[model samples]
Target: MLDTYFNFLQNIERTLGGGRGVKYGLPSTLQKVIALFRVDAAEIRLNQPILAELRLPSQFGDFNRITSETPYTEAVITGAEGHLGTLVLYGSRQWSDNELRVVHLIAQQLGVALENATYFAQMKLKTSELKWIDKFGDSLLNMLSSLQIQEVAGRIMSATKDLLEVEEASIMLKDYESGDLMLWSHTPPEKDLSIRLKPGQGIAGWVVEYGKTAIVNDVKKDPRWEPAIDEKGGFDTRSIIAVPIILDDEIIGVIEGINKVNDIFDESDAQLLRTIAKWSAIGVGNANTYEALKHTTEQLADAKKQTAMAHMVLNLAHKINNSVGAVRVWAMEMADELKATPHPSMEMRLMVENVLHNAEETLLMVRRIRGATELRPGDIRPIEVIEAMETALQFSRVDAAVKVERHYEDGIPRVGADAERLVEVFLHLMNNATDVMNGRGTLTLTCRRAQNGTVEIMIQDDGQGIPDHLRSKIFDPFVTSKSDGLGLGLWMVKLYVELIGGKISVTSTVGKGTIFRITLPPWEK
Candidate 1:
């Protein structure tokens, strides 16, 4: 036994002197210990990363391993950083005092070696992370050099994702117009699960709202995490690190690395993310500004085209109205002539009346077209509000699976708005809500007095909420989330609302729900 101890010490010295780093040191030390003790099997299970020795014939085969609930003798591997791992051994007989002392000494040696290994591994990781950081810095510079704002935005997303080599990454930009977080970009590029977070809604939302760095090794343990995002993204979020993109003392957005490929997120990862965010803030800010301007330019072009089309249609409508007016006068005269003949055939009289009715309907439709092209604001009291909403619901004809909720406060302020346009706005908004809910979920409508004495109205639905990319553009024409939509519903809704001396805005969360708020200028009777 004393000779075996000498051999083990000599082998350990050779392993330490080999200078092959800690990878071979651990298993080699275990092999030497096994040979000295003559154990049937041996294993070393790490604590931090949960790594364990492979089941080679010489190392281990079949044995339960744990700090507790295992049959084998357990040797605690203690290091400077608390317990490093556990060394389980299977020996045929109980150890003598000398043997036990030898085991303890081996474990102590292993602990020191493991502590050194852990530190070395960390340094290596830092070196690798620094390389990634350097790459990201170069990518940011390239992105900044690009004149295309959209391309720059996309590169920022890919660079951040590659910086940490995480399974998934996302960038959520805040809409200062609505105070909502919009998913700016996501990777893997194929999984374009457009996500949106209401202010202070989820982990990313929390980071953006508070302008803080969040490094969560386990999302399940964090209160700020919203698991619904995982369902939307189609992944299990084990860990996350989120950092805010601040510009000019304002949190413009949040950048996140989710589910590290092989490890949990740590300060080094956070530091890299923070560094990227700090350097890319100007780029992100400029990109967003350019996007907003581009979107507005497109909207103006669309609006101009629509205006020209409406002008031409209005002219045609006027011609149709004049022709129909002449027809109605002729029909009236014919009806009068038919009435004068007491013995006229009933069929002939009926024909004359039908012509008059058709002419009158045509004229009414032409007038309606004119009315729709113009904003005609009028008194909109609670009665008109209820009627318009009910009429809209009737028009939309939501599925039976959709539940409706209506709340009207006692002092619901009366506002001035075009009554007909109001119904159209509600109709379009409700139709959108129905589509998002997939014919199921609850639709809530509320009308009350706001703090500023204005009438506040809300149309809410528990549904698959709007995507972040399209959320800010909900009121912009040709920006629809639906696979089969003209994308003009919310655009019309906004147009009508604003034209009627009111304001409309929306807030949404992916898979949770959405709410559209409307405020109208109060009008006293």
Candidate 2:
């Protein structure tokens, strides 16, 4: 519509005898009126005067300086029944009434053209803004699926920088424990920047402290401007828009766009940033929730595993106790019959004594095994190391060919432990020694008080020592050299010993012997 009107003006100028054309190509009809009035210059104004100007048909020097003596006329331009602006002509000629009417008719058309052009430009600007807003919304939606707080924050900051056309942007979240604003993410990737602010410290801080949006057009002019940041980062901040990231009526953080490119920030920029801040808060909230849930799941899985292990231990203890009890009964009966024989030979006497001792130790071991499965803090007490070793040795059933010796210091302090659990530990070490010896090595048990006020026990055996490769992981579960062993004995032994406030260690040489040392805290009355 505006182009058609402009074409009409062009044809009018051609019809009029105003030489070839004018500088701004005024309509020939309007040109004839300007010539009749001897106007040197003409202007077409819209909404505000001087919005546009029409070229003169010929050189009309310095028309702006035309005095009252000069011939000139002013006419109002009306469009859509509303006053658009004025058409003013400066010249030195008399204008007839017919000529004046012609100018008015053309000025009215000019007004409509101007109005249409104005609306067109405004619509184009709005279209661009809507596109950017759509893109911004899309970017935020993508961030919603992010499970990492840092990733969400970085995306938000990058989107803000691009959408707002800012030189720098950052997201800062408050540290709940320390009451400080930690810079979580920023655009342009400032690897060396470590920004932390207290509440009410900087522009970002002010937004957080007040839970409001702030627009600083000139940092130097605003008293709230914090120069320390610029000085530290070597940046000159000319403008900024900071808005609080609010969640559930609480400000969790702040989003800031600094130094808008080629323009000062306005309320409109603040409004955009505020919208983005809302979405960012939601993204951060979702990410945090995901992380918390993941941690909880892992903890629950660990608890379940521990529960299963405990059940397995209890079941196995019950089965072993039943079988061990039967063996103890038969062994005791045979030992009694051997001792009852009159004038028994020395060898026969020795055999009977060994049988009796083994039976007693087997019974003690059965009790200990059962006790191990039912361990509790209240069942713990001070245990004499020598008595526990004696029971463990007898139960170990060391071969008659293997020499067994005991060296226990008199008055050695008792150790705080579960008696049955402690005995189980000794049984594991002795059994391991017997397997390495293959039924023909020396096994020595020793006990003494350590300088640390703890009772130290050592079980030394001259057997085919543990292979060097297996020593490091000997105490680990499911690690063993025995074909029939489940490999958990030493691991459990280590576990039980530690539970009773003790430490266990081993020293061994391949093809020679191995020594297992344990230190237990002394029991206090």
Candidate 3:
């Protein structure tokens, strides 16, 4: 044994300066030592396979041939702190004290060499993991910048599969309305599968329900394994790791990797998945917040536009009223002078009367526009629906060819409203109905008591109804289907109805007709 040690040291000295640098070449060194000791056979085993096996020359033949029946001496290679592996030497004779001591020395040297190699390998793995994490984080940031939620989710699933070397990965999000776990994205997409899990129903659901990570090395052995999914999709799940995606201390979803490639899932894989889930949560939250902010900004812009439009309407109404009032006074004076003249021609009399009537009508229109645009606070009182309808029809400029029908229910309750404003609302609606009918169709006005303690008045027109695309936004400011309309009539009607604690809705069918329903609170007294 002593001579063998000397020869081993000489071999190391010769190989050290060969510039290959401490290539302990442990297997070769062990083989040389075994041959020098003349052991029948020898073998080295590590807790994990760190290097190739070493063997002595065989006249007695292979290690397997020696078998368990053969006598052997074994020494555990203990590192500075832990057992690295075991070293066993087999022979037909019992190992003597000297040979045992030599084996112990060799074991110690092997332990140190194996420990260093293990550390180097682990360091390399950690460096690679760090680089992967950095690249993944950068990619997520870019995805979130685009604010495409589904695209981000798909990329996350792909990155998870690559990072963990998994055969399949999926992202499951909680459906806000259904309260079910929905498969939002998956790698190697399954077009025919529609998977949904309730809370506490499956592995992914369990993670989300309990807000913890799950690592199942063998799905067949786990009670939480749900086989229905596998059976439905013809998929076999051998192992799985699921982690909750938490945001604001709440679990929003779960990310799962299935059947880790060529191996069972372990704590290290679970930890990696948890790290990825954290980044995914952040990306999802940011994207949702960005979408919300964008919607709010659009709403604010619309409100500003409506405010500016209202001011313009008020200014125009005032300017036109001033001009029209002067013309109304001049026409009235001219009509009076023509009537007072004796023997005046009938043509002059008829023309003067027409001018006076037109001037009065123009002044009335200016007043209605002013009332609708100004939105001024007015007297509120019990208003009889029939009386208000009569006033509106009296002021309306309906075409002579159009037919008008009125149906008033007896004993209907009066509505609580500003009589003057309500009159203006009805007048605008009647005018709109007339314009749509194009001087030929029927305009029907009906009044009744609604079940909800309100007065319901419906104005139905058998004119070409509003188009489908324009119906939804018909009441919004500056939206109109008319070439000569200001688009403010319906908007003002909506604003006035809402201000008076009423609701208005319209049902229209293109090329058929339209019905506008207005409901107002019934007068208590």
Candidate 4:
């Protein structure tokens, strides 16, 4: 293993001078060891990025920091000269102690060598700056692609630390509404730095407040730079550089790199930092816009649906009114014909009188229909559960065909929903159950007090149950097990229940029966 490490070091030198820098490349011995243990996350972060970019394997890809609490196994090794870097094996689960020891040694040697390479390469301006700029750009792009904003910020923070050769790094974002700057991401406390600053309160805040970049070559001499490292993170503040993240003339956030490792940050460092900050601003703006548009579009679609349903109700009322008018005309004609035929039989005469009476009643119902509307905020009030169930049964015409059973708990609490809407739901469910019975089986409606201060309604039918395969998608729009169904009834019922902050569920046993349970928050008794 010793000989292999020595040889690999020689190969790294040769590769850096002759080929492109890669981030990870393993020696034959390390490769064999990694393969034997089935280690999927073998990584190499060479100290000398130039050598790393040339010698490291491309398969390992890039490394970034995390915003959330990500559990990982990490080992840090210091060289003879006290040079520091890290070897992180992230993800959960432990490796053998023997393998861990070797990993630590390998990571130390790799970090030291890379560090040496970077120290020597810093003398060259163009090559070092170009490489760091490319790395920073790649890190920003990765953050933009991430689903979580904090994770992306974490990655950018760590990458900035590496590229700037700084001891600590952080990203602070502004809350426009609160006018506060918050620590969005930072290296863990164990990583040798602790720094926290409020927006417009500390050096981080100054950058956001002024919308400009600030560089303190020496922290001791700066007045705006507060030395509260002990109060915040328990570390000394020496040198600091902060840059604002500006988007569309507004300062959205700031990124700061603290304590340069070797030299004070120069114009080259500032150039690279500003370039990264520009790209980051663009990514953040796009994400914010997308989230806002999604919320607005959803609300607009809901409004349109309610409007369309209201229009349907109006049209239905008009049709019913016209039918009632025709019935009134027919009854008047029958009365006139009966009166003109004075010798008519008693049965015929009585039938004519009955028809006239029914017509008058039907006209009164038509007037009521014109005034009746869908249950809305103003139309809803506390109503008795059993009474609503009975009304629904009458509307569904189920009582005439199916055997009806009603189980009501005395003093069952009222619910906070539209009484008419509840009736509509009961009617839909009862009619479905009746159809399942095909005019033979029993239809049961039960209302009772529930354990959670809510009312429970169960509609059960002793008929062929819904198929198992269809149950999973039963609430989805346009999914129906019925042959003649429009497939919207169950979907609409679920939507209405959810809108009212209630729940509905179904359970069925094949060849036995199906039961639907609905629970709603109760109104005051």
Candidate 5:
């Protein structure tokens, strides 16, 4: 009977292979054994507190003594070397003498078989861990090849959850200056676990602060764990294991796993978690460095562009100044000659009037150029949308030729944007529409409130719509469909719109006209 029972335990391990080996293997065979013993239920409780089954033990009839009122019988049977063992039986009546002998025989062999099965399980677990590590190593290599920090961190969290076989996993980054740990990435609760930790607070923070791994076998009992996130997440935590992500002696982040599948996390989980932490640290460091370099490069480029623009502006101002001075002198000379003559011919008077008008226009043009160039970021004002549109249309001198329609929402709040830039934006759009219409089509300027508390300004044209392929490049610098277009008009308009924290988008279909929408944050009225 002992040999037969040993064989039954051995076969049970083989029956429950793969991921189910740890869960479905023992309880099932143990149930059959309970039936054989005529007990209502049977269980194999390993290391206490892990109860697999529960029932009144009075039906088995396999115990010689009953010590507790529960009427359960428990025995300790040793293996080849007196190893720790457990066998419990309960029943209503004593078994037959032969049956009792068979029970003892089965108990003795059960101890040896359970020991072997447990050892086999440990080996299989180790093998599965190795396979996981290999897969993780391959994935790490691929992520490294791409040099994407967030993607690598995301993958690391995912791998940590899978390798640790936990309910959830997350990676938290440490801010050394603020001493705060921020949640970076995580395998969501559905995939693994969901947890958030602050610096020097939860397991993740403690690991980051100390630059070491910390294991909490039961999170519910750990005082270091907080209930801060429980209200929002609506889930109770059971266990946690956090490993510090360190790179070059600097603590960067923490990788954490929550709720092990069968039991508390062991050495294998610690080992894999540490490995992932190390690689994730490297990936995070690379990402930070890349971002820093990118920011620096952008600053340098902007500085250089500003320097070049300053030089161009100075040169342009010098040329304009000289030309304006010469035109002013010519206009004064013509006025003087008109006054000196007794009756300056009608043609001469008309010529002098034209000269004065052209001089005033040139000076105004110079002033407008200077104003456009001098405006900077953060200079915003509240200009009525209808008023700005009317001003731009009047300046364009197309109100007579083109049908200018203004649709302004009453009580619309003002927009926090530079008035000059906004005018330029409207002017560009209106000018482009006028050109498209050959100065004869209807141009509508509509204003309304946007979904995000921003003001939406739409400038629609009734002329031929932009081609689908050309719409994308319409705002690009030096890309224009018009033969006489400077191309910088729309480009400058886009720059000013974006500079004032506004967004511009165009939607057009062939033969249906085009609409340009500009959205700007509404100002406090």
Candidate 6:
């Protein structure tokens, strides 16, 4: 009989969350319990405070489920929190005291197993919540760091709805213009975008007026509840969590979340809003300061303005880089965790991978914006006009009239260069050549060894050439002759050339043609 008990116990352990353990793994384990005990029937009845499972326990075919009046042996099932459910056994004969203990032992293990499973499930849910919240923080920081202040409020309000599981959230900035609070961001956005509130009038106003966070579970019971805004916006107010956006001891705005979608407002939601509010303040201030500096820079002479702008951008990039690093760490940790986990969801893995890719891309873009050209110098083979050829090839698809000629000398030396940037240099020049030719001229690409232990390349175009006056300033930032050009192309080409220890020059005529010559040093020993 003890052996039989051990086998049954082992069976329960085997199917703890899976097999017959309880329809949890124990669903079949419970059915096996009947056979092991030689009982006619058995049932597990759920008690108060359902942690996860909601369905009534199976009683098998034609067997009655346990009830208050049923005469049967009982084994109470309990978890860490206390009584979770009950296990009942029905038989043809009287049961002994020893048998009852074994029955209780089995029931106890089932309860413990179910409880463990519940906690694991809860942990996954919390992990998911934390993941999104971290991502939300990253999103907000990136927006603020980029000076995209105009879009930040709406995004914060909309995202807070999902973060707090709420319906109808808004960000309200204290309006000095009208001595009131103006609704800056609204979810399920209203047709009338700008709505104002009187000073200290509503819950949001009260937060700003008092310089504190507000957590209102029931707006109906709070005297500070303002129904006018709800009536005007055609939204209902149930629960509220509003936080003040403070900067340097001054409250600038309010973030109000109205009516939680599931449960009422809690301290956790208030705390999240508080953190977000601080970030929002930084965002607002950065946008204002950036604009002011931009205006001032515009007023300065060209040389001074370029130097000042470069400094400003590099500083902004440094700040943003630190924030972006945090995002990257989160992504990397998420990826490692996903990989370590057994049977991780495909969607989650893909999402983490996508985040990592985006973080790397954004980092590169930030560096680019700072005018910081990162390089990976290597022993690159002789200049491949392949990139320019590819561009010409692509252009050839559109117009068969344009002729492309590629010339390469057999003994060209390998150059030290960042190959990717080198490709960009050629692509940009080739694109210009194709554009100028206007579909009916010659685009020549040449690559050869130079006399001075260097590699030489040239892109010559036979359609409308650059004016001599413009050629001198052609490599200067924003100095484009094209009517629609931002003028950064030639500047970038010059920058890229110089960065890799190379040189670029150009000669052109107004009506004849243009040739861009580039020389790159040979790879070091």
Against the reference, the lDDT scores of all candidates come to: 0.70, 0.70, 0.73, 0.65, 0.64, 0.69
TM-scores, each model vs. reference: 0.51, 0.37, 0.41, 0.34, 0.41, 0.32
Clashes of each: 0, 5, 0, 14, 7, 13
Task: Please identify model 1 stretches exceeding 4 Å from their true place.
Answer: 1-137, 146-150, 161-168, 173-184, 192-210, 215-241, 258-271, 375-384, 390-412, 418-525
Model 6: lDDT equals: 0.69
* Candidate 5 lDDT over residue span 1-525, tens digit each: 434434453454354431124344445555666666665443333442222221212223333343445454455543323434466655555565434544444454444444333433444455566876556555544333322466666677677776678987777776554667877777573443344465688777778777778888887788778777655565567888898878767777888888898888878788878876765665565455444433543444454555565466546766876798798899889888889999889988888888888878767655654554456555767767767777777777465778878888887777766666567668778888988888888989898886567888899998899977788777664578888764556656665676667788899888879999988777775
lDDT of 2 by residue, 255-300 (tens): 8898899888887788778877876776676566545433543444
Q: What is candidate 1's lDDT per residue for 403-438, written digit by digit as tens?
A: 999898785645666666678778878887898788
lDDT of 3 by residue, 1-525 (tens): 344454454463243221122244554666666676676777776675555322212122266668668887788875433576788877766666656665666665555445444433444455566875555554433333333467667778877888888998988989875779998888678556789999898899899999989999899999999999899777888999999998768788999999989888888788779877876775576446434433543444465557677778778777877887887788788878877888888988788788778877777766766655444544567888889998998999776787888899899887777788898899989988998888688989999876666889999999999998889899876689988776877988987787778899999998889999999888776
Q: TM-score winner between 4 and 5, please give it.
A: 5
Residue 129, model 6: lDDT of 74
1-525: candidate 6 lDDT, tens digit per residue: 544555566556567632123345655676787777677677667675443342434464236544555567788886544687888777656676546656777776666556545543433455477865555654544434333456666667655776677877888887774678987777886556667878788888889889888999988999998787778777778888999988668878898888888788778888778766765666565455435433433333344445554466557678889998899999999999988998999999989888889889878856554442445444344544445446545634326677778798876666666555566677778778878888678888898876666778898998789877787778776688789986666766776677778899998988989999998887665
Kindly state the number of residue pairs that clash in model 3: 0
Quote the positional error of residue 97 for candidate 6 in Å.
99
Model 1, residue 293: distance off in Å is 1.4
Residue 245's lDDT within candidate 6 is 87
Judged by whole-model lDDT over C-alpha atoms, candidate 5 comes out at 0.64
Compare the candidates by lDDT and give the number of the best one: 3
Model 5: which ten-residue window has the lowest total lDDT?
49-58
Candidate 6's C-alpha runs over 4 A off are: 1-136, 297-525
Give the better candidate number (2 or 3) by TM-score: 3
